[model samples]
Target: MTIRVVLTDDQPLVRAALQMVITDTADIEVVGEAEDGAEAVRLTAELAPDVVVMDLRMPGMDGIEATGLITAGTGATRVVVLTTFDDDDYVYGALHAGASGFLVKDMALDDILAAIRIVAAGDALIAPAVTRRLIKEFTRPVVSPPRWSELDGITAREREVLTLVGRGLSNTEIAGELSISIATAKTYLTRLLAKLNARDRVQLVILAYEAGLVATSQ
Candidate 1:
């Protein structure tokens, strides 16, 4: 199946460039384009693309607000924030606003495509630098442990997977940490998503941080 994508940017040149790069791939399609955030949201609601490549500095709605609304309202439409600035401040905002990943605009075409594919697969794309900063930026007052109450339906192993995932481990890494197979790790991840009612791993990561599963310790 082709990966349907929507590109949202104030610049026609940049959006066109992205479209050109993505179209080179056989499995990706530029389903539509949006000039600003409001239009991005409207088109997203209508088209329901698999992925949205969002620019941070749009004129009207801006990437941050658009990301929040898009992720909150859409089903299965993952957003990857793109920008020339890696100022670090924007990182938290984008993720908190519901971006699945952040990519510096200068990234290679292949990396950009990979980021989209990663988000579409329901895995987060935050590198260690971003994850560390995001954790520090967001985890101010530590919250309570993840409750067995809300987590009633989750299995013990799934709980284990969530905790490690919350710790920022990838699937391969998580499997090695738990002495399980990669397939088993993915299964646990799937189960965690279902039980926690999380749309994707990004939300799961947020939940873990909120529930005190991981934090920047003293």
Candidate 2:
């Protein structure tokens, strides 16, 4: 199956570079390109790509707001926020705005492609280093009110899964750590998602951090 992609960056060079890399992949296709947030939203509505590679610093709508609109309105198109090291505050907004995942701009092209594929497959990816940094910067003395009801009705084992997830472990890694099958790990995640009313794994991670289920000490 071809994974349709839309590239959005204010810089033409960046958009062109990403388009070149994505178009080279066997299973990915660049269906549209947008140089700003509003254009991204419009193109996403028109093309309905499987994934959108979005730049966070664009003018007008900006990627954070764009991500919110795209995810909220379309429901099917996933947004991958592209950011630099100084964009931690924006990263926090992006997370709450329904981004599927985030990527540092300087990451290898192969990793970026893999992230898109992972998110398109309905999983979230946050590099461990990036996750730690964001948590360190965003963690407040008081977390916002619980997204759901303070983890009520959740089992101890499920809390373990959520911790690993908040720490940015993939399902395969979580299964290995717990000596369980991958399917079982996925089942736990699905249950957590439903119980917490999360839109996806990214939201689960946010909840885990906000609820102090995961620490930012690392």
Candidate 3:
């Protein structure tokens, strides 16, 4: 199936570059483009693309607000936030606002394409550098553990999976860590999402951090 995408950025060059890279793929297509958050939102509503490559600092609505609107407004559309290292301050907010993942602005074009496909396939991603920073940044706070009843539906093995996910381990890594098959690891993640009412892997990571399952040791 062809994955439809919408590009949103204040820079025309960035949008053009992204369009070129995406359209080069046989299974991906750039369906629309927007120069700001409000336009992104409007185009998303109209195009209903499978994924949206959203810049974090667009004028008017901005990426965080646009991500929230796009994710909430369309059940099938996911947003991948594009940012520079300077935009790290907004990463947490963007994830909270429902971005499926994020990509550094200067990352390899191949990596950016992979991220889009990963999110389009119902998984989440964060650039490795962003992951390291996210761990360091959120680990500064000491949070209380959530109640057992809150996690009553999750099995111990599933809790283990969540912890790995919180640490930014991919499905294959989680499988290797637990001596399970990748398919089994994915199954555990799906169950975790349904049981926790989490939206995606990013939310699972946030929940694990908030509940002190991971990123608590200093």
Candidate 4:
């Protein structure tokens, strides 16, 4: 199935580059382009593309707000935040705003395409470099207390899975770490998602951090 995509970036060069690469892919196609967040939202509503590649900063609205609006307003279309800035604020903001994927501009174009595909398939992704920083950032003591209630209904095994996920381990790695099969790892992940009401893996990572399942030294 073809995955329709909308490119939302203020830089024409970035959009053009992405479009050029995406057009070469048989499964993915660029359906629309937006220079700002508002236009992105409008285009998303009109085009109903499978995914939107959003930029963090724009003249109006901004990617975070647009991401929230797109995800909240439509169940079919997902947002992938692609930006030059990997600042902690932008990372947390985009994830909190319902972005299905978070990537930095410095990543290879092919990886970006893969991320779009992953998100279009109803999964979530975050760049490896960004994920490491995200873990470290969350390790710092916060002014507010951790939300332990979020993990109330989850089992101990599910909490283990969430901790591995927060550490950016893949399913295979999680399975290996826990002496389980890959399918079992996936099942635990799925259960965690449902039990925690997480939107995707990214949110699970955030929740794991918020619940203090991930430690600073680890």
* CA lDDT, every model vs. true structure: 0.79, 0.85, 0.84, 0.84
lDDT of 4 by residue, 131-210 (tens): 77766763454446888987888888888888889888888888999999999999998898888888898888877777
The TM-score between candidate 1 and the true structure equals 0.80
Would you list the clashing residue pairs of candidate 3? Answer: none
Give the best candidate by TM-score: 4
Pitting candidate 1 against candidate 2, the one with the higher TM-score is 2
- Kindly provide the TM-score of model 3 when superposed on the true structure, using C-alpha atoms: 0.87
lDDT of 1 by residue, 77-119 (tens): 9899887544455655776788888777788889888888888
- Runs in model 2 deviating more than 4 A are 127-130, 137-143, 148-150, 172-182, 216-218
Estimate the overall C-alpha local distance difference test score of candidate 3: 0.84
User: How far is 142's C-alpha from truth in model 3 (Å)?
Assistant: 7.7
lDDT over C-alpha atoms for residue 86 of model 3 = 66
Which of candidates 2 and 3 is the stronger one according to lDDT?
2
Clashes of each: 0, 0, 0, 0
> Model 4 — which ten-residue stretch has the worst lDDT?
134-143
- What TM-score, to 2 decimals, does candidate 4 have? 0.91
The top-ranked prediction according to lDDT is 2
**Runs in model 4 with CA error above 4 Å?**
127-130, 137-144, 216-218
